[model samples]
Target: MFQDNLTDLLENVQNGALSITDAVSRLKTLPFEDLGYAKVDHHRSIRNGFPEVIYCEGKTTDQIRGIFLVLMRSENNILATRASSENFAGVRQIAPNAVYYQQARCIVVNPVKKNQDANHYIAVVTAGTSDIPVAEEAAVTAETFGNHVERIYDVGVAGLHRLLAQLDRLRKADVVIVVAGMEGALASVVGGLVEHPVLAVPTSVGYGASLHGIAALLTMLNSCASGISVVNIDNGFGAAYSASLIIKEIMNGCQE
Candidate 1:
């Protein structure tokens, strides 16, 4: 909607159909819209390069639908994380185009399609097959935000050769998101191998001693590798967000 309004304003100016003051007046409300329960920030895409994303876990179905409607009015794409099938049903009532990713637990409305450069991509690596859910969340989030993503799964430190075999593939990524639960050693190993940024995500995929991923979280936080950064336990979305921002900056630099 923002882009459409800007285009209309420019066309109006060219045709002398509207004054500059009128265009400015129309744009003032483009920043935000208040809906009592929520104040949707329409200008977030302008300011942050990405629109606000809905966290559907705590919100009621009605609340999610309402928020999704307001955000869909914008030109930017809409993403709702941690959304259940029921939440998707509510959103689909208003947006028939919306799709639910069961494994990723995410709902995407009017997903943005970009011709991504192969050289500029995010690599999502997992320590075990059990970690793929969390890894998929990270991969989906990064891809939704217009970044090319490559998956390198089940390459834990148990068999160093598996990870070692993918050294060339891992190195090709501009940013690497390492997802693990047991001991969280994969992040450090990837960090040590790559020259690019490493964003580690710990999942609650371990056994009794793992303490619901706390042990892995602590392990990642204390990683000795130089450029290793960690997010909260099971926070694949957060890891992807940080990686997207890093990739965006790199893209901007290349364009300049």
Candidate 2:
């Protein structure tokens, strides 16, 4: 929808249906819009492939709805991370079709399946069942961006056999995101096996000595695997964002 608007604006200028001055007035909201409480980045999709995502953790229900309404006008896929049931309630008031992922704790509005590179896909792996919330966040984010995702859960290193069993499936992904909590060794193991880029998400899902996932974060950062990249603790969204960019590049290069 964001791209559609930009194209429409250019077409209007080219066909002389709208004057340059009039177009400028319409585009004055390009970079951002100030809503007193927040500066909504309306131009985010122009800069990046996806539009700005609402991080609903700290915002009020009214604020989330306000931003959701503004972005809805643009018609792009809308995603709000760390959202509660209350947040979804607020968003649903304006966007009746909005859906909430309970496990992922995310609210999605205008989710359009993007299968430009359906043959290619992302694999979202988790070390244990406890890490699924974070893993779900990554998977949903990728899907919201129109990217295909393969979820492989609870295949941590402790069992070894579980992960080994899914080796064939994991090998086929364009990019792999390994989400782990304790020690975070799963990322290294998967990184060693997969030839593609490996994104490690350290989750806050361990005992007291885990230091609230700091241990896992440090372990992932110091992995012996060559192509492993680590995101912040419980940052499935960040890992997914990077993986989406990788998938985009691969899809574009194939067309070229």
1-256: candidate 2 lDDT, tens digit per residue = 5557778999999999999988877775554667889888886775676789999988999999999988898766799999999999988998999999999999999877665465799999999999999999999999888898999999999899999999988999999999999889999999999999999999989999999999999999999999999999999999999999999999889889
For candidate 2, give the lDDT of residue 196. 93
TM-score per candidate, chains pooled? 0.88, 0.89
- Candidate 2 weakest lDDT stretch, 10 residues: 25-34
Question: Model 1, 178-229: lDDT tens per residue?
Answer: 9999899999999999999999999999889999999999999999999988
Model 2, which residues run further than 4 Å from truth?
A: 1-29
Best by TM-score: 2
lDDT of each: 0.89, 0.91
